[model samples]
Target chain A: MLTFKVKRRIIYLGIFCFTLFLCFFYVIKTLNQSLLYFKTPSEIFDDQNLDLSKEIRLGGMVKKNSIKVNKREIQFIITDLKKEILVSYKGTVPNLFLEEKGVIAEGKLKDKKFFIANRVLAKHDENYKPPSENQLDKK
Target chain B: MMRNLFSLNKIYIFSEKTLTFIKSVFPVLLILGLTFALVLSPPDYLQGDVVRIMYVHVPSAWIALGTFSTLTVLSIINFIFKIKILEIVNLCIAPIGLLFTCLAIITGSIWAEPTWGTWWAWDARLTSMIVLMFFYVMIIYSQKHIKPKNRSLMFTSIISIIGAINIPIIKYSVEWWNTLHQPASIKITGETSIHSSMLMPLMLMLLILLLYSALIFLMKYKTEIIKVKRSGVKRL
Candidate 1:
């Protein structure tokens, strides 16, 4: 009887997990096809698991003086301190999108490091501040 | 032995016990759930009919938090009162809360992207729900790392209580802060924030969800009882 009960619990747990697993993937993959997974430049070049065909987002702070625009196409560089990615966009840009600010560019890669953006999202949560030195000293 | 004393109830005193209770309750819940499903529940006036999803959303949210709260208190009871039943109750509620939390997040997410223009926002409710989900998964996963004895319950209860402080924050955050999430459409004021026509199906669906939640709650609790009984027998 104990064996039967343990077996039942294990089976139920397995069933619940399997269902959630399926639902999670169904939602993610559907979102993946429609939208894009935001990834950093270093995450891509460092050889992470990412779908190449589907859309993706390249996010980082815009490197200083790395912006170039010619008619419909705009090119810029995104830096994550150690490395950077050349990003180009072919559509309307977000209002707050510009140099030295954190930007998330949605598209796919073209060359080894070049990103073609279809949509862009500007960073909104910018009130980040470190606790004062006095607070740290108290701790 | 404790089961015998409670068996002599007022109304349903059939000796053919376990099967009898299951048979009776099962159809009632099924009928209640089925009737609401049939009504097709008229659309909410403001949200239109899409708000019928609230039927599922609210109960899941309710049960999700309710189950977690139950778990926390039972865990505390197990520690303080040293009640063995409370410990089992705490264990049983953990995964049940996780299940409802999963349901709540998914239903909320599906409803969110359509109306809110995005699947998720960093509003207090959504943020806390994400953190709750993370904590749920972490607690469940960390169960393996913990000793099988009651030592894990102490730490788990602490985590549960700490996470619970956020529930009130989530409830009031919409009022306190600027948020994309709309405030509660239904309220205690009785001014009928939603149209009367929509209220019927909405209430119906709410009933269905409550019944469904109770049904699942009983099912999970029953199975948990069996497990505890089995484990006790093993130790014997």
Candidate 2:
């Protein structure tokens, strides 16, 4: 009876080990799938054969005076100091998307140096804005 | 045999002064913290009024993680030393931790809708936080439903040890993998990405929420002890 009880406990321990191993493996595999959410200009610049069919996000700072508002299309350059990629979007940009500020555009690569953006996100700094003119009157 | 692990009339009880201190101080702190977080603080330049959600959302995440860490430590000791008090502590902390985890997920969902253009994402940090919450639910369920008190406690302690590994994964998920969730603004290197004006109220809200959780834990602990004592006596 004692030997039988010991054998059962060992089996339980083995099962526990197998389950833990499988859970960790599953998490890591899923994590690898999510690795393409964003890429910097330097990363894309280093890659020789970039995927144009798959949509990707290009994140960097907007170069000063690089923003040009055309009738339907808006064009700007995103730079990471080492390299620059021009992003063109056909949609309205966020309010915080200012020149020389941080921004991330979601779209596909047009070429090695140009990106066609589906959406433009303006990354805001951490500071809070004080109440504006109309908001001050209520106080 | 395991059903009688805790006998009647031997549970720890808090002193009157301690109860009074928690009762009187926590409400004042809560009101002051809420007023500052909701009204006095300035809105974000980009996020505007929606940024106010951070006061509640961020602190809940912090407290949830903190509670889980405490549970992990207590469970480890319980596993090694088999201390009875530590088992009770583990049971008491689980529900409070679950409450905070739920609050963090719900408030985060609300905040994300305005800021991220979507209510949910498979972001690494978000997914791992949800996993932590599931662990909390598992702990609570096993404790409540598992038969034979000693076996249930042992199972819970082991489960907690297994779940402790996920806490670090949740903390560093943003850095390890590229995701939509932003990287942590506050760093242990003494540099904060946020300005002082916004930091002050946020810190206050976090402090009050911690105090509130502590108070709830103490009250729940007392009630759990009382329940055990009553049940044990009735079986006698």
Interface RMSD of each: 16.7, 5.4
> Worst 10-residue stretch by lDDT in candidate 2 chain B?
B7-16
Colliding residue pairs in candidate 2: none
Taking the tens digit of each residue's C-alpha lDDT, what string does model 2 give over A6-113? 566556655765787689768777857555457889999888877789988888889999999989999999998889999999987766678877787889998989
Full-model lDDT for every candidate: 0.61, 0.79
**Which candidate gets the maximum TM-score versus the true structure?**
2
RMSD of each: 15.9, 6.2
TM-score of each: 0.54, 0.80
lDDT of 1 by residue, B1-236 (tens): 64554332311233235435655776776566545644544543223344556667766777777776776666544444455556555654567678878888898877765443356655556766777777676666554367876667656765765566556655655555434455556656755555454455556655555555555555555665666567778788
Candidate 1 per-residue C-alpha lDDT over A2-98 given as tens digits, one digit per residue, 9 for 90 to 100: 4565566456545744775567557535644323224567767886665678776676788899989999798999888877889888876654466
Where does model 1 exceed 4 Å of error?
A1-139, B1-40, B142-145, B188-192, B231-236
Instruction: Give the native contact fraction of candidate 1.
Output: 0.00
Model 2 residue runs over 4 Å out of place are A1-33, A122-139, B1-12, B15-17, B234-236
TM-score of chain A of each: 0.61, 0.68
